[model samples]
Target: MATHGQDPLLHSEVRQASTGGYFAGYAASIVLMLAALLVTQQHVLTYPAFLWVIFSLVVIALVAQAALFFGLGLSPAQAWKSVSLILTLPLFVFTIGLSVWMFHSLAPRVMPDTMPGMDMTQQPTLLE
Candidate 1:
């Protein structure tokens, strides 16, 4: 049982939520979102640079949210959660990559030739 100001949940020495930590995490997310918006709405970057910047922001936001909101870290107590996330991320990326590859491969076989420099006469009419 907790006495005075001690958290009852922390009696077992397990981590307990801190108001300050939650607020800091919330503030960081809000700031990051605002920054990403500024980069997009103001056209701060162009083409590939823009894409990379947005991607980087997204990645940073993901890490920050995970660490702050979920208490995820490489510490022994939290290592499992971090490891699980790392392992799962690659699978998600692979799934998306395979889907894109499948679609790209399928398009050529199923769609009629409409682009320039491609032979269009031999293939049957798309509409008829």
Candidate 2:
């Protein structure tokens, strides 16, 4: 619980929030989302290239959100929380990366290449 004079923002051991920072984060988030939609819909790059581009954009947006909206900074009070979050971030990234790798590795063996519109699980016709 906060003492009588303490602001709610600082009630916890975290950095204080600023109105300008919030606005910047919100605007940046919207812009990044729009950019992602445009890149995907317009097909600016082919296949994996565009996918990687969007992934990079998403990471940037997440960082901006964390810094501006969540007030993740080098404040003395917030130091431990910030450090823990940073430490755990790589674990999350590695989990996602490994999952994608596993899926791609198994895809070829479990599902053979087929026509774009064809269903791989369908039975073949004997007459045809």
Candidate 3:
């Protein structure tokens, strides 16, 4: 029987490489998220739709970082982490979808019926 040192499945070099990659990916994700926040705060991307796109990209980056950090190996701990992430993916999608739907549904009810400085209604009609 091969010991851990000589085992085909677990190599010190591979573990080190995986750790380094995970750290690097996580650092990059943090930087990207911060940059996105700064851009939004500065009004560099003022449109709500564009901001949502940026948020989606950040979510994707976060998932990529998690996968890199947790899913690269077959050790028992890594396997558990990967399984948890896989199971949570659907929940994440559902939460985002439900939140967006609720926000859009409630916006008109909460907004004033007319614009502050104009005769026209603040609510836009499809034909307008």
Candidate 4:
């Protein structure tokens, strides 16, 4: 007679135990993410728009960690495992897009106009 250990599939009890560990890890990750968000918010004034990059990095890290450890169980064949990578790609793209848009929108206002020394007055003075 073959022992349970000889079986290729894991026993229910063992699987449950592994899943419990994953859950605990996931919970800890969430707590860390929240703490990071709070800290980022508090210091945002010092960094201005740069804070968004930090936030995006934290979010991406937390999501990846959770997915890898907790296994979303989206499919019997582990289709959920791919979700972390898929989600991360879009997040990076969005972050870059926001950063670029903000820079372009704000930079022009901060710098002098390209037509240097040109007066922008809408109406000329009576003496001129």
Candidate 5:
């Protein structure tokens, strides 16, 4: 019964993307990115704290993109999708956290402690 040019998946049940929503999502993403760039370039945070700040900003941007672009939300139509994402979020977080941990833990072991131009003796020890 379907027409050759008609796609069943594009039926009324599927939510259409709105231009306003798309623009809002795009703007929010850009703003978040610029904020992160500013924080990094200005040295708003130092070393490990800077990394954490950037990570948090990225997570916020991800949520904004999901809500505006992917239609992820709490409405009846999107409840299941929202719940599914929430359920799987822990796995995603765990995977990324573990990957970072592994890389940091292994780096000192795999790479030389001192660079060619730097003297190991010049570096301060925790006991100092």
Candidate 6:
């Protein structure tokens, strides 16, 4: 229950909105973006390790944004929001992955077999 009147329909289970959390989430997002840029600019890790680190940072940032910025939590009232997000996450990733895979498969088939100006035919000389 809130001291000030809050719309029951909107916030049935009320939680105090925190400016600190919002700022923290924003700062964290900025740091993650800078870290990604640094990772791309400086080759500090091998390919596999570099990819894993970037992926880990991305997942952490996603969670931070979901919790702090979006106010998603595991509480009874908010659990459904979290559940829905989790359910949709895989679908979203899968759709993007599938799109890239399709493009990769499509590229080779559509590419020209040879250079634009090169002629493949063998022309017999007049002496022959």
Error of 1 at 127 (Å): 26
Candidate 3 Cα misplacement greater than 4 A, ranges: 1-19, 72-84, 106-128
Top-down lDDT ranking: 2, 5, 6, 1, 3, 4
Clashing pairs in 4: none
Which portions of model 4 show Cα errors greater than 4 Å?
Answer: 1-19, 41-45, 48-53, 64-76, 79-88, 95-119, 122-128
lDDT of 2 at 47: 91
Query: Which candidate leads the pack in TM-score?
Result: 2
Residues 14-127 of candidate 3: C-alpha lDDT, one tens digit per residue: 554566777878887888887777777776554887668687878878767766654445565467667777789899999999999998878655655533553345555779
C-alpha lDDT values of all predictions:
0.79, 0.82, 0.69, 0.63, 0.82, 0.81
Cα displacement (angstroms), candidate 1, residue 120, comes to 1.4
For candidate 2, write residues 43-124 as lDDT tens digits. 6698999989899899999999988888888877667778999999999989999999998888855665533545656635
Candidate 2 residue pairs that clash: none
Off by over 4 Å in 5: 1-15, 102-128
Total clashing pairs for each candidate:
0, 0, 0, 0, 0, 0
TM-score of 5: 0.66
Clashing pairs in 1: none
Q: Which ten residues in a row have the lowest lDDT in candidate 3?
A: 112-121
TM-score of 1: 0.70
Q: What is the lDDT of residue 84 in candidate 3?
A: 75
Question: How big is the positional error of residue 86 in model 2, measured in Å on the Cα after superposition?
Answer: 1.3
Model 6 spans with C-alpha error above 4 angstroms? 1-14, 43-51, 109-128
Give the RMSD in angstroms, all C-alphas superposed, for model 2.
6.4
lDDT of 3: 0.69
Candidates arranged by TM-score, highest first:
2, 1, 6, 5, 3, 4
Candidate 4 global Cα RMSD: 9.1
TM-score of each: 0.70, 0.73, 0.52, 0.40, 0.66, 0.66
Q: Residue 76, candidate 4: how far off, in angstroms?
A: 8.7
> Which consecutive 10 residues in model 6 have the weakest lDDT in total?
115-124
